[model samples]
Target: MEEEKILAIDYLATTPVTAKDKRLKARRDPWMSRVLRYTLEGWPTTVDNELLPYWRRHEELSVREVCVLWCDRVIIPRVERPAIIAELHFGHPGMTKMKAVARSYLWWPGMDKNLEGTVRACERCQQRVKAPPRALLHPQLLPKRLWSRIHVDYAGSFMGRMFLVTVDAFSKWLDVYATQSATTEVTSEKRKTSFAIHGIPERLVSDNGTCFTSSEFRTFCESQGIIHTKSTPYHPSSNRLAERAVQTFKDGSRKLETRSLNETLQTFC
Candidate 1:
């Protein structure tokens, strides 16, 4: 018959040791070793009277055989503490679920408190917590004049070409320009051409796309004496003026199935 492997604490205390074994010992070794030694020998009179019942049940068994400390429940050995907890709490489960799983298995002193702390400290669990209440919307004042505030955005590769879309906040005037690329340089040049025709707007608004948020784009707006404003990150309604225009353009383009790209642009113009 195969001999039962001794508990970790018992093996460490009785076996011949090397310098490496001493260095690799856990911080709780002293306390665990003493507990194992006391368990192997008969319980002393000074031992906690509260544990008398547990000792009576387990006294007949060797230290390796009765690794569990059954005072409250079957308490796991110190060496297996972290691994057992991790297995019970895998997938960063919520506190209630973790507690339920832990209670179903071998336990330790302060197990509930330690589980709480572990779950609380988990970065993934913290991130998955419900977000705080969203603040109320504070809408921007309506523009008093045409071209005073302009919203810009990009739409489509309808015919293998993207369009730079601009919409005036007050007039609701829409301008769509087919572009070879959506790079900052290309977009800035397109905007410059439009600015020359319509005059530069007091405020230019766009989404947080790379073309709009680029340093080059900001410099271009600065040079033109235009205030550049970006809509709230991931909030499309803030730039609804440009979004509506893009939708309108796409809806109109879809109907002109027989028309070529140039013909479609001419019809829209």
Candidate 2:
């Protein structure tokens, strides 16, 4: 409706064509050109309110013109469709905005089938309805040796008690501590016990949780000669191994049933 209203053309007249020339020779398609020109002229009025900063800046381009030029000329002809789909799913600002941005580029494939299913199967969209593409930050480095690089994170408790896990970077060994309260004092005591058993690590990596960020924890790390490292506030990849470990655990769990269903059932029983 907005596209039709903004383009000032009957939707039926603007048949979707997967032609690079559509955008390239946009000025030549008399009917389409008039609609695109008018849309571009009225972009400031129609899209100014709905779009973000980047999209807003392209107000000089009509809806059809922008779609044709940006989609066909820039995206379809040059960029791979799968990559474009991924970028649409992950790299864009928001889901709604991404779809809106994608609509401009979406065209009949140049001798391909319907892309609706492919577009819908995007994982990011499946996980988050309309989340914006978060800018990726640089990976942080550990300031020490292999096992000395300790990463502690809490997980599960989805069905049972939460487990605080300390992972060794080298051996991929995990030391899990089941805890009732994730208090600063409790966490400190657990860390001390862990250090006593496994010896002090050169560096410790953790989320910016209250327990991890507490003065007591910092003092404890300082006292133990262990450097405390806080992960990027919300980014998990700061200690990327944690993600890998979780995936490994999930994969192994999935395999357990398949590799030996009888053994798995026996073990559970």
Candidate 3:
């Protein structure tokens, strides 16, 4: 049943009763018929002004059976032009690709502009257009003092507990704290504990996770006189220091089997 429905849709899309097909059929009217007949009957010395160009370009032209004219292809009628463009763009290719495909088997004046217009107006193509290329990375300035700038991130729900990890940008010192949950309060508490040990950082960088972006986290940073900066969403390279520390901790934890979380943390430190 599904296959039959799909076939029926295909048939409808390609049916000859469409507006383009009807206009193509209408090309058999007097003026076009006469032009086709003249092309077939051989070039006239004094041709219709409209047809003089075709005759002059006759070396590039061909005539099909049933008196249809071809110039690299069956000369598409004006009303059927959009239909041909639509067919070539069925794959929703960009303007250049569509124009290349059309040129392979078709020719018409202003066809390039028409293909571009069709592609631009295509909803699917517009919706699926790729994002602009990312800008090159601009590295942050190095911290002059140890623990002045810290990159912080969370790692794990390993063994049902989460660990907050911080890495000092200058000294590369790492601090890890296990927490019951990754909520803003728990994360802030863990960060406070680390600040007490290393002294408060002048700047803190982190990914745009909920715990980092929460109002409570902002308030905590404000109270501590810490400048909070977030990396671009979904981009871990911008937070590479913290990410590296998290990976290191995870690797160490995985190596110690049958050890409690505190034991693993101690081993990692």
Candidate 4:
């Protein structure tokens, strides 16, 4: 039985590790190490109050190369979360960009709220994240496949920079970039990163902003064999999914704004 358990451990340690992984292994996190042990030895039928969160995700929890993974994302150790947050927030990415980066490969309880706290603590972000008032709109069309139809828009001069936000019509996956300019050229360059990863969408939707309506942008879309579309100019109820998505992004990031830190800790505690 011990040999079989050892074999299972070795088999489960196949995921590749990075400097981050090395650091994680060295830390010997009490909670994460316990979770790793449970994954190998099997979880108890019931858990302590502290282990309840991990228990809820026990079915998806996995051990990967000495790291605990929730799905494909690494379960960040509490001690390491601050560093991860700093790395992801290095570019001073806005709420959308921050969440996009965080959701890519990291997970911890209250991660989203913590990210929001980091942003709210920033005097600079509070100063520059002014966006247009959201307008009510009808439902936007959903696509059959990811990257088939995407709604794109600008969020703000957030953090003293322009943000280009694109929402996948199917997955609703958000792509955000912080740029010094919102020019058509810059927008095209930013979209290239997303397009490279997800492939160019067959249909691209955006409001009739100059960045989208400009002849240069039209040419760029044509070159990529993309079908460029514009939302109705003034009618709020027409087509505005991109704006709605941006609104959702902004709203979700700030939902915890009113809570005090001590209160936040008490709830989690």
Query: Model 4 off-target regions past 4 Å?
Result: 1-140, 233-239, 251-269
Which tens-of-lDDT digit does each residue in 1-269 have in candidate 3? 33322322342225423334534553745445555667667666777666655566666665544323344444544555667776666545457666775565555556788887886887656644563533433455667899998999999988788989988988777788988888998998888788888899999999989999999999999999999989985655478778878976775566455677776776555
What residue runs in model 2 are displaced by over 4 Å at the alpha carbon? 1-146, 233-237, 246-269
**Residue 257 lDDT in model 2?**
36
- Best first by lDDT, ranked: 4, 3, 1, 2
In model 4, residue pairs whose N, Cα or C atoms come closer than 3 Å (at least 3 residues apart or on different chains), thus clashing, are none
lDDT score, residue 172, model 4?
71
RMSD of 3: 20.7
Candidate number that wins on TM-score, 2 or 3: 3
Model 3 lDDT, residue 239, Cα: 84
Whole-model lDDT per candidate: 0.67, 0.53, 0.69, 0.70
Return model 1's CA RMSD, one decimal. Answer: 23.0
Q: Indicate which candidate wins on lDDT.
A: 4
Please give the range of 10 consecutive residues that has the lowest summed lDDT in model 2.
7-16
Better of 2 and 4 by TM-score: 4
Model 1 lDDT at residue 178: 95
TM-score of model number 3: 0.46
**What is the per-residue lDDT of model 4 for residues 1-269, given as tens digits with 9 covering 90 to 100?**
33322432232213233546645663667777788889878999998887788899999988766667777667777766777777555435567777876676677888899999998897655644775655433355456688898889987654455667788877777776667888999999988887998898999988888999999999999999999878786753233677876665455434434544333222212
lDDT for residue 216 in candidate 1, whole number 0-100: 93
lDDT of 3: 0.69
Candidate 2 residue pairs in clash (backbone atoms < 3 Å):
39-62, 40-62, 93-132
